[model samples]
Target: MTLELNQLSDQVQALSATAAERLASLERQRPAAEARLRAIGLADDELQGKVRAALRYRWAGAIPAAEPVDAAFPCPPHPARANVLAADGSQVYPDRHGVALYYLINVGSIAFRHGSGEAPRVASRPAVFYEDADLYEEEGRQKPVEKIDAERDRRELGELARLAAANADAPAVALLDNGLLLYFSLQAQDRAEIKRELAPYLAHLSALRDSGAAVAGIVDRPRAAGVARLLHLHTLPMEALKDHADLFQQDADFRHLTDGALFADRLQPGERSALFENGSPANLDHFQPAGHSVFFFYLNPGPAGRHALLRVEVPEWVAHDPARLDLVHAALVEQCRATGGFPYVLMRAHELAVVTVAERRELEQMVVAALVRRGLSLSVSHKAQGKAWTGAGRRRYP
Candidate 1:
């Protein structure tokens, strides 16, 4: 019995010692992990503070009220025509070597009538453009893929802008997929080059706007959306307060909370409706400063329907941040070191907006289909009823 007791005591002491060692090791690991994060370009106090402030302003429920502006032309004259345009770009990952090949897809359409009642007809085929991967050697180191993506983005946007401007007609409304104007405010090593590339497009857009036409550029994935989502999630009750804690424990449960049933049961009957009612679709506009990316969202609502635009900004910080790139490099190095080969490195853009052009089209089609589904005949057509010409000894008749 004495021998058994001694053995038991020894085992307990050994277990305690192991636990202590593990705790100390974890303590040591925490700082190292934090340092690694910092090395990967985690913002210090000032940058983080700025990010927070930007977020706060975005979700403060303080949307600015626009002062009404006088119209350029009074009514009771000729009816004005409006046009809608949207453009988006996608990148292709060519191989496992982290090479980025880019393509731009631009769509523009014209609407002849006003209000949400009339459907717009397609005016032009979606233009597809591509840019080849460019390579540059710096101190025997090739330029990073992120820089290439930024350069391509600038080039593609410039082309899209020019195309839209050329197609604009009298008293028309132009919608840009990303922002009201190209962001000349990017901080890249090739900043001047980017500006020079975009100058013509910028001038054209400015000229169009200056002419009495209402030209608006929108960035649908504005960084404000992420901040708004964060604020929204914070407003929900804690899991402990819920009757079924298990159901609300995970983020997926909260994210797929579209039905309003889970949250409804916890609140008063009327309060349940209020919780899910005022919500907008998820906003994706998150700022990746180290990556030098900005997402923006813009919306223009006329009599017919709302025109939405999405813009993504890729800046120089994506390539310049050594710490940011190091994490990627380390991951590749580790895989290569372990497996005797590394897998392809491909980075994807995080979605910044759920309401894409596809989604908008789907919604619009649904509405039109619903009318047909209810057995109503729908007809759409365009006819030139009249023609008027100004100047140059021409007959004004159609």
Candidate 2:
């Protein structure tokens, strides 16, 4: 057998014990985290001063907006007539051993018009890249997976922009199945690369904003510790913060605590936490200047006892405008109500975008037929051929 389950019994027992201990630790820390969050005053000039000072050291935390840090705003009334547009993207990465050196990205989108009772609009846009420039970087190296993923993300946002522009007459909320900030900056080689990657994304954000649509990036079961970091920073004295260089490191008080866990209890069913500006360097450096600084809040699109935590990220413009912000919050809650906890539109978009293995094989077969018609000899590598032949087998234990 490639892997024997019997061999993992002892390790599995130890892992279970470790998880139990971590849960105990999480329970012990939960109350203190909640208390600290509830105690912070939004207008505390001293606290804001401290956070601003800590920002200089690249502290990854949450900055308070107009709402109180402990505020739990109930879901606003959903607009009687509104548009909820969502887009999701999937990709098939290039396989070197396959018939062709090409990758494909397909984006699926849905435009659900509330109160209209009309059938929702759906679309799936697919693009295949085979050109040398599309496959290779400036130095002729094959493009990394991150670059390709960034391209998919760009297309997803661009699709949302197009959808939003077309539905500008009504109150609309455009949703993405990710964070608003593009993570490509972390892998960027230089400032130029960062700018190049962000230009198109920023332009799309502008387009969405100009189209009078509120845009948001929704993350389910988020692992972000931005709020926890803020609570940890609050515990430190100003004197210690001044002396400590790496002030953002998690201490014993709140190690491994996430914002999702922190707000799970505080936010009741169909409620959202106070908005906080993200203090990441990318937000402060590039996006903020372009007037798209990202702000996020925790939400529980719930049914009474169960907790379904989500982190909803919006730009500065949406956060400041009352109507747009309300539309985003209410539209999400209404959308989630249709599918238990998560938004129905996002689920449908993902289902439409996903590429199955059978579909991939059919695509390869079509490529082979095209080559054969042109009298060109094209075949998979020897290893790929052998693997295909032996792919199906039953596991055996030794």
Candidate 3:
């Protein structure tokens, strides 16, 4: 009722028509992209040369790997007796208006024993930060949510590493409900700060690598166009790429295309696309030097008709080892088949980690009781209290 849909009917219809036109345009462009993919696969060396030259100009894109660009690899045979370990993390961000000024991170994991038909082991670990160092930056400003989210990501991978190491009896595949590359917006941060933030995450990856576990990061319906950007670079004349400034900024035919949309029809159910090395500075400059360069492939872990595309990223160690690569592919397909499209373990882990509203209210109540025991004020900010009073009601105007 607040949205006034009737007044927006014309605009909605126009938006729908624009969407339809965009789809048609994308369809017309698909064949050319596919052709370019095939052409580059036939002459990968030429593309590689171009990628090498273009790397200094751009921040992040995709670089071709050992696999042919057009290759559609079938799902490899899964291990008869393997283990699948997945971890997910959720957080309660600090609310200045609330009684407490702290954030919490909870990581949930599942250790599934394949071929034994035994029940999977699940666990969750939660930690709260209240120290000034944890809550604020050197400038005395409250730490941003992105920094906290980075910590949560680190904990998720750390949990997977711990579980993978312990469940070493069988070949283990450690899964994360995220991309292997760090997602924190580090472009604005100083080099020293960036290095400090990435240090712990890299350490955890090293742990997973040393544990002899195949690790993978699963992203459902990814909208990444890193590969598409590569294709655009391929389309440009080699001479045109010398201008590092305008090289990637130029408007192009493939601008609207996503790797998912490009590969949606190409990959059959249960098939995966060829691998591509991620060209992000974070992957190339930091992780690669540490022997953990991120590589990715698109997979359709399918039941039949539905095209549930996923981007699976792995470290250099896993990507190079045939057995580890195959296990990640096979195990992921098996996990997806159990839960329609998405991985069942990730679903369960998320469920275990998520904090519901009632639980948050209960936690706040506990905080209030503790504050009262300490003879501290048990009052929320006036703005928050006012919202609590009128949040569910509607306002009328003349």
Q: Pick the candidate with the highest lDDT.
A: 2
Ranking by TM-score: 2, 3, 1
- Cα lDDT tens digits, model 1, 1-398, are 11457668978999999978765554544443323323423234443333344333333211111111110111112223333333334433222221122222323333323223556433333322222324443454444545544444444444444544654553333333443323433333364554554555445444543443343333332332232232233333443224333222333312322111121122221110110001111111211322212222111111112222122221223123333222222222221232232111111011221235575446445545877788876543222112112222444466
lDDT (Cα atoms) of all candidates against the true structure: 0.32, 0.89, 0.88
lDDT of residue 259 for candidate 3 = 91
Candidate 1 RMSD to the real structure:
26.3
The TM-score obtained by model 2 is 0.96
For model 3, residues 1-398, the per-residue Cα lDDT tens digits are: 25688999999999999999988988988998888888788436767878888887654778888888889999989989999999999999999999889888989999999987899999989898989999999999999988998999999999998999899999999999999877773453566776788889999999999999999999998998888888788877778777766556733677589898889899988899999899977777778888999999999999788769999999999999999999999998999998878989999999989888888888889889999999998689999999898776778788
Better of 1 and 2 by lDDT: 2
Backbone clash numbers for all candidates listed: 24, 0, 0
List the lowest-lDDT window of 10 residues for candidate 2.
Answer: 242-251
The TM-scores of all predictions, comma-separated, are: 0.31, 0.96, 0.95
- What C-alpha lDDT, on a 0 to 100 scale, does residue 201 get in candidate 1? 49
In model 1, the worst 10-residue window by lDDT is 269-278
| Winner on TM-score (2 vs 3) | 2
Model 2 lDDT tens row, 97-210: 998899999999999988888999999999999999889998989998888899999999999999998887689999999999887865665878888889999999999999
